[model samples]
Target: MSFILFLRQLGLSLAEIKAILTSDYSEQTLLLNKKQALQEEIARLQALEQTIDDQLQQVNQQDTLQVDQPIHLRVLQRLPFAQDFDLSVVETIDWQPDWMLRQLYYVINETDYAICMATPAVSDYQIDAGCYVTTTIEAASGAEFDSALAAITTHQTLPLIGIEMRGTFLSPGKHLAVKILGNRKE
Candidate 1:
């Protein structure tokens, strides 16, 4: 076949072939650049996500706390008033080394109190108030303080149920029954 005829038979119109090759190369270059950009973006996003996950893990580890058991404590004070408080159980952890302390505290009326009740009170009917394990727990402010105060205010204040006033100078009432605090096991 003549060279010109052979070219025609091969389906090559010079200008058309050149145009197709140029466009194909251009598309390929564009696709490669897009792939690189996408890879960079994906890497950046992954790094950001990893950083966020690490922060979350740190926070969870720092604040992770639980209550091991319930603690019941009683306090006798000179304050002449009937009051009962219930506080949220924050940290139920072993005290320092061996003993376990179940912390219960409340916050209310600007007063905060904490009680580290002993796990399994020594006496079922009576909790030894003077025991080292059953001491008054107090807080500064914030969540801890609020919790402590709440514990003391939630319980009902029983009006003078039974009381004994002494001396011939006993003003008016013969008997006064103040509110007594009681605990319901959780």
Candidate 2:
């Protein structure tokens, strides 16, 4: 005879029969439900892992492009002519191995002066001889100086340390406005 029928014949109430059946099967049902929940959680975590791997691949590809790009920096200011008729512009720049100095622009209010840049060398002497870039300015405009600097092909890549405008100025209140431009791989 069925368990439920046998229990009913023994004078068990309907609520008592239901309670016995539920207690007998409750452990198995609970274990099955827990297993199903765990499987769903594992599947969700696997999908998330796949998504993270795809994003990492994209970031690696972008990093390669970024390394080939060039970063440009410049410094611009007007310096007064000192009593020795030389305006000294000192700029201490720390350059990385990938840096490439591209161009230099200068706009002097006077026309007769020459511009030179010096840097510390590997020799015992602290200050190396300067490199002469330009000697005369036709105009005092920024655009004119930029154009002039662009035409010069002899400006080699050198370490920037100090800059000076040497020679006499035409007027008493004359000053020099200089711009240094460079590029580097990032």
Candidate 3:
């Protein structure tokens, strides 16, 4: 009904009504402070989350750059053959900045020389100068050695000398030397 009628029914004085209003205002002030504190906390957490996201993005970018640069393979040297000389490998690495030795692989000669010899060191295609790589192969001997002879006999190109690179990068235009030792039937 009317405010005055309601107060009259309750038999409250104006002074008592004023005191109730003051208590209500106090409760509202406490609630407002709690809401403000929560808002500040939320803002701080959001800022931290954004910082973490930025760091993650930077790490991903570095990973992408590394993907563009791959480790490759190349041959460094070969030596005169012994009767049963063990297989030897050679490698050359070409990195843009600085390269670590881990990029190269050394595979020993086995009966399955082709499979056992191929390593990540050798590129399927050519690599450029300044880029680096490694390579391993069974020294051409017996039938395999004769294969080079046959290839040379059939044409000027020596199939045994066929070289491949990882990509279209330029390679070192020189031959490398490596040594071998094992049982010989001479």
Candidate 4:
């Protein structure tokens, strides 16, 4: 044992020291177990959706998010709604890391991705000119925001032109977009 820990536990019995060593990890392990439980619940619900959604003639195919595909995510609420969306690509920005919380995020078939806010009249440099993984966008402000929500809620497909998904590597107003690739089911 390190001198610091040895001295710290000098007064404790050997059994007590062992407990301290292992007990430190118990709380974190329990919390991580909850993640698995949540995942299993999600799988159960998805199975239920698939089994009961037989009204459609065939199983719904996955939507391949193509390069430069512009997806719309609303910033109206703190939560951007996370789900498979009837089994499409992960289009919504649902969760963010600590420092990154409360900011706009994006994802792809993602492959989850991110984007950023842009000016109304965007410069050509900020338009369809970067690598496929990143882009910028002008999120709907004022009345347009409501319209976007309605359209996305009803149609499940909203074509947003010009605006790129905010990227962290880009300039100010750029939002981070992530795309996880590989390990796709056949």
- Model 4 lDDT at residue 129: 28
Q: State candidate 4's TM-score.
A: 0.20
lDDT against true structure, model 3: 0.34
Better of 2 and 3 by lDDT: 2
Instruction: Name the 10 consecutive residues with the lowest summed lDDT in model 2.
Output: 62-71
lDDT per residue for candidate 3 within 20-113, as digits (tens), equals: 5566546465457657877877766765564455345333432111122443444333333323223333233223221221222222232212
What are the per-model C-alpha RMSD values against the true structure?
25.6, 26.9, 25.2, 17.7
TM-score of 1: 0.21
TM-scores for the candidates: 0.21, 0.21, 0.21, 0.20
| Candidate 2 lDDT, 65-178, residue by residue in tens | 112222222333334422122224334233322122222223232322222221223321122123222223333554665465444323534332222222213234544433
* Pick by lDDT: 1 or 3, better one: 3
Against the reference, the lDDT scores of all candidates come to 0.34, 0.38, 0.34, 0.35
Ordered from best to worst lDDT, the candidate numbers read 2, 4, 3, 1
**lDDT of candidate 2?**
0.38
The model with the greatest lDDT is 2
Candidate 1 Cα errors over 4 Å, as ranges: 1-25, 62-186
Task: In model 4, state the lDDT of residue 83.
Answer: 32
